[model samples]
Target: MVALTDEEKAMRDGRDGDAVAAAMDLLIRYADALGAEQLCETRNVAGTNTQPSPAKTKLFEEGGWSKAFSVISLDCDDDIEVPQMKVPTCQLQHGFGNDALGIMPYSERNIELQAGAESFYSSKGVNVLATCTPYQVGNLPTYGEHIAWMESSAVVYANSVLGARTNCEGGASTGSASITGRIPCWGNHLVENRYGTHLIESGLRMTGFQDWGMFGYFVGDMVQEARPVMIGDLGQPDLADLKHFGAAAASSGGVEMYHIPGRTPDAPTLEAAFGGAAPPESLHYGEAERRAIYDSLNSIGNSEDVDFVLIGCPHASLEQIGRVARALEGRTLSAGTELWVMTPRALRAVSDRNGWTATIERAGGRVLTDSCPAMSRVAPAGTKVFATDSAKQAHYLPAILGIEAWFGTTEECVEAAVTGRWRGSLAPAAVVR
Candidate 1:
């Protein structure tokens, strides 16, 4: 049984309102299920409460957003009035919105439903960041701060890159945490659980976005769900590089955390990554490993006729969007090809203000926000072979949509969108030891 504090008991015994009590009840059950001895305090939560689905629609019709949130988010059957979040909570990416109308196959009714959910949740103090990357849009949790976050890529980034503590929580757990500010103090919440389980080294220097992703895929395939500490002369990785790396790792091997000896916040040295213990025999990311990972990610593709190109997976940063715009500045997409740069609405606004959106639009590409083709399960009318710069998107879009995927660099993907052909190949760097 999980032990509860005085305040926890008060919430469980209905000292708080019905919604808060329901939230507390859900957290207790979740903690107990995880065999957690206690719950930790958290001030940050990232979850999805605005996504529209058939089940959520039915609940909404039955008792409005309150009923939907109570059942789906709080896991409660009671007709409870959802309250303002007790802690800071942000909504993750949801389904397509009005911006997607006529662009794809998403229905208007679902869009309306999602709009309603956004309005309702926003009124209840939910900061709708509406992207998988809450860190980019300023919902960044402080280092060592306990948080309740979902999205595997974000979880890994928080645990590995940002030095924050979080496990892979579900919508229910995050919703409950938002109201109660408590999460099960197990798994990644405890310091001992954050140590490296596998040691890895990369021989080829990684400076490009896709290089980090390929390296990540190799690591994840090797270590699976275990934490890995990477040590090598791999070149400096930027924000977007780590973003692709983490997302690809999560997609390929369900990696929730990793450490780069001197780069990441928590692991300042190789020894610290392993919690000061003797490090394990380091696995090498060499020529064979890089080739196999790249080929595996591109295995689903046989045709070269590209129809769609997706630029972002964890949502494109402002710099990525600008790069795409610059690449497409004076060019036009192929008559049959379409390209979309998925990003947060906040970044989209910035892109618009910076004229990047106009540049891409003039070149016949789009700067889209909030959702991606994979999340919405809708591409251009007849997309058979698609390409993406993101390894995570390349890994999943094939299985999710039954479409062929081409894994390539951002410039290559943009070139495909313009010429309607797949010319991307593994660079010579993949073979050099």
Candidate 2:
């Protein structure tokens, strides 16, 4: 272990007499676990969980733990009422939806308790924003810049995709890091730690959005914890596919970094991504791995009748939303089904300004904002079946919310919403070329 300076020792020993000392100690240890060399000042903090849960809000207010750090800005997937403000109204900059999965699993009373606890942060200048893509909100730190982030996909994307440095911090650690302006320079912060440890070889058979997504899940499961660089006859993937892959990777294996042979910014080639050093071992994925991934994560349709048809795991971009609206021209969601298209709040405004919102609403789908079903604490209750195009949601919803959920392509969900039942099987996306 490296020796700590007197000030660092004092910080660990509660020398400042601030309630944040214990939390800092925990962070330091966590950093050590990741084999970090030092600490770095952090900027831009983001969180996960639909809204503030009681466990999170309480630790911040009643636990004597809240005052430990001075975070400059905060963003998250849920919104909460803020109390007497001291810190600048935090930009509830980005968040996720509770509907992506169905609804939050907790009770309303518990949510109320969490809200009461979170009131303290507002008193210190926290804003309630329900968003998932904080990077879309200008909170992004540049490559090699340190940040305290709690969102799993964002942490992975930033570290592995953008070349920024951060660990998948918890809410409390994130809060304390922002307050202290310092985080253990561990994990993704160090260049040596970012090297690829595993090699993934895939044949070109896996194509289409769903195929690419399952490929990510397959790789995550095969490698377990090793950072892998993908190599093969793999074709190019777009942002939507990458976001889906990243979310699935985060869900399946808790991967902090990945190198895409030609896709990711940092990994223009396999050799470059691997740093000319050989991987510890190589793993190959063919049709068998692909089929296994689908079998493990695919959600079965519930009773051949669908109650809710949802889309937007990473928040559909304008073009995606437009594609749906055009296909849905003069069409309406079946009277029996409640169809909702979810997107980021700002993007919602953009859709409205561009008239896409009216077109979608006119098609019997509401363009909702602020939170997703997986991020929100509530949605229509007792829905027997839920449908989504996101494998990430399909993989986690059953355990997190205890509902019968199914995975499908965006078109399948749209058709289900249109007829109140699934009509078609998964189809490949038409070659965009």
Candidate 3:
């Protein structure tokens, strides 16, 4: 029932090319699955989670590039040449990093495979900027612009912070949308679906990234799928704070969008956020609730002996990298501890230019790019304990790596990285509201 333009119909009918036809067919099925009545043009920006793997390399080696493209991209049994993307598209974070800079522990074969994948995508007109925070780089989507992004944290950020429209696009859907320059018109694409269903009022004076992360964790858990308009007594948060907030919220729950009155682009006022409709219910998040959420996030018990301290779950910004460098300026990590700072290549370039990378490297830390430990799921050998400043990392690392994970402020994580011991307090001395 979805209406397609003449160009789209030609592609679907194999008039353009086999690859375009196959891609259009898949998109038609996708639109049908979504129960969408039509497809809309998307020219703002698009990103795909089309990362490389060893299995994909094997497929290419066995069946040639065309076969590999159809199998990996179109999910089809037949072979087809992959067409160039119609819109500005980039690759999201994958299991690849700059090996010369010791970004990640990749063997020679791993590096070669990663290079092959990158070359393939690059040849097909896809920018291979492999970072989750595409907005930090040159792939920013403006307010109200439609984007087909796949990463969860990036989806929340594009919607809640930048006011761009997108749902939690998956890898295949994003791939289709990128090639076709269109996605099914549903979910957050429609303005009527962007209203606030719940209201969250916070009592804490949020200051740092960790505080905002915990607040987001609490709200995401409480609100679940409901869109929330946050009305709280909070200080003005910067980009880093909102990044951590959106990352943590998307991690703990399925929150694609949120609203902060007078802060975010879409929500100039609460009434505007909800489209003049009253919120169904409101939840209060005070100091006690914050402490409780923090406790629940920490999976480690009394075993403070830490092995790794990680920072940058959504990949650190330039300002955040500077803070890390400043915190560990004169200090070195413990003999048995390691510190890994994950960030995007663009920001890493900035860090290198500003001497932050050298500062952290001199302090026994490595500034890694493209992937995090959780995504790669390969910690240093014999690592039993892990600590991080990201609530999202704290929630996922233990389950993914089966290790003791600790969550705290960036300062606390630095302290743990230096001493190989966790000495951070969970909450302040304020009474519960």
Candidate 4:
């Protein structure tokens, strides 16, 4: 077992008094849980916020979280008006309740709980903006710097794309890291730990949204439990495609880290990401593989029955939103259908200013920000049948909602929403014999 240092011991034992002391205590325990050898100071955290549970509330009153929460910056906050979910409780050992789950059943009591929780963090000076992309905020720690992040896309982006280091974090560990300004020097921190273990060779010329998302799921499915460095004759994929792949891979096979050769920073070339270690396995991805991946992940059905259609899982990029607006031109969604396009709130505002939001809304789609069906757990609860373009959403909805969710291309989802039934083919053209 990795041992905590004297400073960590004092903090855990509450010898340092309040505020910073309480925060350090949590960080030490979190590091200990991960068997981390030492702490790395963290400058940022990205995740959702919730109402304080009984233990957390008590701690706030008696300990220093009340003070610590006042100063930290949180990427997102929980809302009582949105849908609620039953999730494994996060940091603070908050009990499993709507308050802890940060879901909506917003009676006056629940509202009070939500407010009380917000007050604790608000009093601590944490930014209460409801968002997932904190890198958009400001002064993001540069590549190779240590960060603590919980949002899947941000974690991958920081590690694989931006060249920063962090592990797949939780809210509790994040909060603890924020308080102590340090995280265990583990996972992505070590240079040796960042090397790729799996090799992905792509034959398809993947460029657009659907292709990218499907390709990501393909790679993720094939490279389970391995860090993949994608290498091939593949051309540059857009940021939307990267987001789609990262989110899908994370959702599908627990791939919190991946390096795209020539695109990602750390892996300027395949050789560097590998660091001289030979890949244990190499998988080839082609049109057939993409179609097969889509077939495997996608529910085979033409029956629409879709009550909801969601487009953004990792938050739509500006270009993706523009494409959506262009595709939906002059088309109206079915009156009964609910369509949501999610993006980072800041980006959403930019779209709103540029008239992309209106264009999408005019075509019967509403744009939401900082939250999605997966994180918000909103659409899945009341929804019987769900439709999304993201493999991540498709993969998680079944486990999270206990409902059958269908994965399709954005066009397929849009057409389904318009017709109140699936109008797309069960098999992609690449898969038909």
Best by lDDT: 1
TM-score of predicted model 3? 0.95
Tens digits of lDDT, candidate 1, 1-433: 8999999999888887998899989999999999999999999999999988789899999999999999999999999988889999999988988888888878889899999899999999999889999999988888999999999989999998999999999989999999999999999999999999999888788859989999988888899999988987887899899999999889889899899988999889988999999999989888778889989989999999999999989899888998999899889999999999999999999999999999999988888888888787889889999999898999888888999999999999999999999999988673334
What is the lDDT of every predicted structure here?
0.91, 0.64, 0.82, 0.65
Q: Candidate 2: worst 10 consecutive residues by lDDT?
A: 68-77
State, as a TM-score between 0 and 1, how close model 1 is to the true structure: 0.98
Q: Against the true structure, what is each candidate's TM-score?
A: 0.98, 0.81, 0.95, 0.80
How many angstroms is residue 292 displaced in model 1 relative to the true structure, after the best TM-score fit? Answer: 0.5
Task: Count residue pairs with overlapping backbones in model 3.
Answer: 0
User: lDDT tens digits, residues 15-50, model 4?
Assistant: 644544555656656667778788876666554455
lDDT of 1 at 310: 95
Query: Against the true structure, whose TM-score is highest?
Result: 1
Q: Rank the candidates by TM-score, best first.
A: 1, 3, 2, 4
Worst 10 residues of 4 by lDDT: 78-87
Better of 1 and 2 by lDDT: 1
Ranking by lDDT: 1, 3, 4, 2
Which segments of model 1 are wrong by more than 4 Å? 430-433
What are the per-residue Cα lDDT tens digits for candidate 3 across 1-433? 7898888898789886777777778778988998888777786444543445666767877885556667666666676777877788888887755543343455556566667767877888888778889889888888999888888899999999999998887766667777778788888989999988899987777867888999999888988876888986677899889999988888888899999999999989999999998766678888778878888988464589999999988899898899899999989999899998889888999999999999999999888888887877767777899999999989898888889988998989999999999988775723324
lDDT of 3 at 427: 55
